[model samples]
Target: MRPTFLPSLIVLAALLLCGCDAPVDHYPPNELYSLVVSTREMVSTQVAADDTTAVVEAWFGTPVQPRWPADQMSGSAAKALVRLDNLERAAGRVYADQDDLHFGLYNEHCVTCHGVSGGGNGPASLLQNPYPRDFRAGVFKWKSTARNARPTRDDLIKILQHGAAGSAMPTFRLIPEQDLEALVDYVIFLSVRGQFERELISGAVQELEYDEARPSDGLSLMSIVGGDEESEALSFARETLDRITDGWARADDAVIQVPPETVADAASIQRGREWFHSPKALCSGCHGQDGDHPLALQTNYDDWTTEFTSRIGITPSDREAVRPFRSAGALRPRIIVPRKLSDGVFRGGDDPQTVYRRLVTGIDGTPMPAVNVSDQPSATGLTSDQIWDIVHYVRSLGESE
Candidate 1:
């Protein structure tokens, strides 16, 4: 069965009956909506095929057709997909209530903008100024975990609860908690799937000489022909899946726990200012003197500009709001300019805990990196106290403004 927006509408009606206030309509454009519906049809057909293996192949298969003679669903690749799909199915059964709603929750609400494969290339993606997130790359802009780690579940949930301040992504706070959990699970599923697919493609292209032009390359698994190669390929696939899944599973374990609240006083603020200017943190490098200014041309591009401009036919000359998604398609490609910290408006909330998470997680997809400090001793990292001092300093920048 195909999914519909009626569930959202139903929720809206219930809200009205209860006198609860909430956003009734968060629908995307008709073109994007149609695209999602069609994509679901394709998925349903693939899943409904008599051969279950075909479902695995189609869902996890590479976008690039291999040119070489290859088994597209090699034994090892098949094993990996089977395992991952099991988890996906389990997540679906446990989190999502129905079949049609499985991954499409993320697809309709997210994929319409974030992309079916999480590559941030949804039909409407290019229209937005800051293009939607490309989950395939596994780089989230807002996180509360350590470097190169998955965003903590709470981190993902928080973003859903409170949407990003300057983006097209809306807050899903009003959705039932179960629905929210299902969506988050599906998103993580897509992220892991996309990342693994990337790894498999890279491995096949590099090691197996995947070529699409070869007659034997049609839907064949990237199988290993020799004994040594087979063992190596199987080992490699297992290791890759482990690493990818483990990174996500371990995110919560690595969350940066802030120490109890402390007063943002003169001494702490002074210390923070010093840290900001220090070569280690390099706050002054981009956010020059008092966070209001940058020292250079500041050409840093956000993920949107880096990935979508050329695809959408946007050019350097198009500066003002020239995109449809932004300013109703009137604005130009939006630049992901670094925030003016001195302005005192924190897009990710100004609360102390939020500030600490940003410092630790280093806003996922953006250029802003997490501070190199921990509560424990490290020759290279900072202690929690040090980060607190810096946080105080940043907070002060807004106050002084």
Candidate 2:
């Protein structure tokens, strides 16, 4: 059965029933983790992280007052990704604008758990097992995009319309379409901003130096990143802002290629069963032979929990080390328990096509891996037809249970 996460729903329902007001003030600026400070092994000083913060604020602005350089990025670069007006409407307090148009849609629907910074650290952040997604990481658990590619706009909208069944994320299908579009815009905006911040953080630890005298150089680096042009020195972060926006603009092309589904007959399922236990696919490694693994055997950390915990000497299972982070706003870390497929409770939709996407792309920020598939009948990886058989087997396991 899917997790109810009733406490969170109760809290949200109570607040809405009591007419709790959402904040309209300045956004809580995103920042570096305190765990990094404790590590002391960081190459960038506190000053550099501060500088990066300023650069991010300059480009994105505060939650109450949102903006981007529309003039700087003419043509389809910036505006094509998301409108500033939509962002303004999506952010800040839950109130109407001067024209009486609705604003703060995100505040009304998202801020309680997503946090003002979209870091998934609001009061209710730690109340769930998998935890609300930290949009800052720019990694989504469900999507049709290729690995490391930004999700298509449709992907975000679908998640909003049909919330994850086993998690705290709820469906907003009853909400107005315009409001839903605004929320989608806000999600993309946060993902873009957060990815840039993370890139600089990585840059600081790897390439940058903490200069006491020249503090403004970080802004200069951002000039190339957010300035429509960037150098190759920073591979991932190189042109990060441009790359992110452009990536979103071109996400339609990034979808994984899916072929015609093979018939799901008994013979196909038997073949799939063989592949399930085989070392090549190895589905039993985590989910178990019956596809009903117990939580005791499943211990995997998500990208957000692993950000600090995956350090050379640290891990989420270490309670003492993460205590400071938890006290400071980071949620209590939990293992990403594998799903009991035999129970027929797929977190992402269980439709054949959706399952095909899951197997092809894998879930982002989790231990699930993409199965290798090729068009040709190659010996190295499973073909599209072969994968469909595996899908049939997976679905049959649920029925047998």
The CA-based lDDT of model 2 is what? 0.73
Please report the candidate that would top TM-score against the real structure: 2
Could you tell me which 10 consecutive residues in candidate 2 have the lowest summed lDDT?
Answer: 210-219
lDDT of each: 0.56, 0.73
lDDT of 1 by residue, 93-168 (tens): 1134465334334533665576545566666766775677767667776776666777877778788888877667
Off by over 4 Å in 1: 1-104, 127-129, 211-235, 294-299, 302-335, 372-383, 399-401
Candidate 2 TM-score to native = 0.84
| Best by the lDDT measure | 2
My TM-score estimates for the predictions, one after another, are 0.62, 0.84
CA error at residue 331 for candidate 2, angstroms: 1.4
lDDT of 1 at 331: 23
